[model samples]
Target: MTQDSRQSVYERITATIAAAIEAGAGDFRMPWHTDGTMSAHPVNITTGKPYRGINTIALWAAAQGAGYGSAIWGTYRQWAACGAQVRRGEKAALVVFWKIDEREEDAGDMDDGQSDPRRRVLARGYPVFNAAQVEGYTPPPLPALPASARIAHAERFFAALGVTVREGGTRACYIPARDEIRLPPFAAFRDPIAYYATLAHEATHWTGHPDRCARELKGRFGSESYAAEELVAELGAAYLCADLGLACEPRPDHAAYVASWLTVLRNDARAIFTAAAQAQRAADWMHARQPFAA
Candidate 1:
């Protein structure tokens, strides 16, 4: 791929997500939010691994737009390798990967006779088709855990993070000064999913503390930095929920942030890419705390 390939990948993914956000703006829905059909995170059917970073968001947006019930996806050849064929005329979605370009260069001011090796990582786009667009293959069945078990699992997950979370508040937020998370009692939420989802959001914020991911969360209200942080937390929560096999729902209070997010994306084509990468880091940080984390 050429230099233009990198910009096109970012622009294409950004435009897809921006369009999904705009389509859902009226209902306060986000591209990341999962309806029950999309209960699972986007995964590569061949690799059986969840997509990460911008790929996850980009595929989710594609699934949401196309009403794909399955979260599994793969390259056209991958599907064929799995004994499935993409249906006629089915279009593919874009995902990106970084390719390293390594070269030996003159080492300036170095006594070593050997030239130093220089490496440049470039973003390259790959097209993948959803399982829903294929025939003769099936995604593995999702486990059906009881509600109590699911909540217990979430509790254990949060406890493992070791973040100081204080229950009993009218709103949920991460207090950067205190380096703690605050949320209303679990009973305050409409359901277990809502409670855990809210916790995930705040936990993402907690990951951004100066000692952690170091995102700028102390910016003035309505500032671009503040809004970007919110966007990161939102995407982080969605990613975490998907990984945990929970359906993420859009928070009603966060509707106001959508306009700001759109503004950010419109102002900078790479905004979504940066936000998704930051969100992935936040989610990975939380996952690393899990006892069974790979």
Candidate 2:
């Protein structure tokens, strides 16, 4: 297929998969295992093995499901290959090529019913490149923050989120055991305005603690829940940035979780609104906490 056509196909397939996930479609399982009429070629490390039948193919798909962060669905390269010859009434088996990372071997290479489970070796391999290379997909640059912002502005942002910032020698910002917020020395604060921006972001997260707003902050770093929190913080920062007429400095750390965010957003249309509200509340809480200059 032409590159453009292949890309179109990939987009369609990925969209379908994303929609299915959003609609509550659980992990993909081997159809043969569900039915009872398919098998795979025996693994021969010496000669390598070709994926055979729908069950084996589905198993590979299941393995792909375990990918995390931006690595999910690692580089799929599909090509139509010759089918196995069959008897007069038998259906032909199409060969589906899968070039995945060696790390996925354990999940992808499990035998249906003829091997010791302990024999599985989780060896890892790096792929130079298989497919995920699309042109013109550059991410927009992160926004920049200006210098010369007052410490009071930072305090105000914290107060709006219902947190108070304590002055300390250190230049870092953190919530104090879910009670009060503490910020590092303003002098120590790097890029004063951005430092507060970062503080606002973290303060928003602090609100989610059980002792605070009690937002569920329980998910693996790359899972949907974590991504949701990140989205909240980003929105919160954006809101505060707009209020202060500051540039919205993008959180570079968030790039790692972008795929998961995409997944969550695709799954729930309402999630964006909920996260945004919580973010705004957090921003407001911070703004309320700033000490007013007399």
Candidate 3:
């Protein structure tokens, strides 16, 4: 894709997500949500490979808006190849991928502090329809899981992280000063999943402490940096929850930060990329601390 097309790609995706946030203001249900699938990343039906980076956010937003329960999505040609047909009147979701091309270059790898002329980075986008939009593709439905399940695995995994977690409080938060995590008694949460999900979120925050990952964690509650950090923690929690097979539902409390995130993304189209990368780092940090494979 050309530079102009790449700009259009970012604008188009940002617009789609911005519109979804506007429509979901009251309900607070949109992208960054998972249900019975237990936080499975959206995957392409043809490739059966999970999307990464901004495409994850875009597809999740599209699926949530379209009420697609199955996480399978594919392009028109891909759907046909998979023996599935996109139903008439169904709209396709936008998905982007990076394409690298090689051309003739000088002997030196770098020229005048610029990248090698032989290599080029291209941002390409295509349309993909979710399983719900495909007529002949019946993705096996995920069994409904009751609110009550053994979250003991999650508890054990997180507890082994070696972070200082203290109970007994109405709010759950991470204290960067002392690198401590505080949460209400486990019994206070309506379900074990909620309790562990919240814990996972705070633990992600704790990973960003200055003594640890040392991310930009000093921003006040409503600042852009603060919103960015929260987005990282949210995405990190989603990654962790998926690994632990736990529902990573969007919390109503995070509604206040959505506008800030939108502002950051609208001002800088690449903000989502940075957020996703940092989130991956945060999740990796937590995962590395796990005592052992469960």
List the candidate numbers ranked by TM-score, top first.
1, 3, 2
Q: What TM-scores do the predictions have?
A: 0.89, 0.39, 0.81
Stretches of candidate 1 off by over 4 Å are 35-39, 101-119, 217-223
> Could you tell which candidate, 1 or 3, scores higher by lDDT?
1
- Supply candidate 2's per-residue lDDT for 72: 15
lDDT of 3 at 12: 85
Among all candidates shown, the one with the greatest lDDT: 1
Q: For residues 152-212, what per-residue lDDT tens digits would candidate 1 score against the true structure?
A: 7788898999989898869898887888888999789899888898899999988887777
In model 1, residue pairs whose N, Cα or C atoms come closer than 3 Å (at least 3 residues apart or on different chains), thus clashing, are none
- Give the per-residue lDDT of model 3 (tens digit) for 9-126: 7778877877776667677765766753543678777666667646776787887777777778788999999788888988888877656565332111111112345767566778
TM-score of the candidate numbered 2?
A: 0.39
Q: Could you tell me how far off, in angstroms, the CA of residue 7 lies in candidate 1 after the best superposition?
A: 1.0
Can you write out model 2's per-residue Cα lDDT over 1-294, one digit (the tens) per residue?
Answer: 355643443343334334433333232221111110011121211223423222222222333343211111222121111111112332212112322333343222221122255553332222211112222232224344333443455455455555566677654444546466566666765466666666656666676666655666343223467677876665555555545544444444444655675577466533443454466555555555556522
How many backbone collisions does model 1 have?
0
After superposition on all CA atoms, what RMSD does each candidate show versus the true structure? 6.6, 21.0, 5.9
Q: Please report, as a residue range, the 10-residue window in candidate 2 with the lowest summed lDDT.
A: 30-39
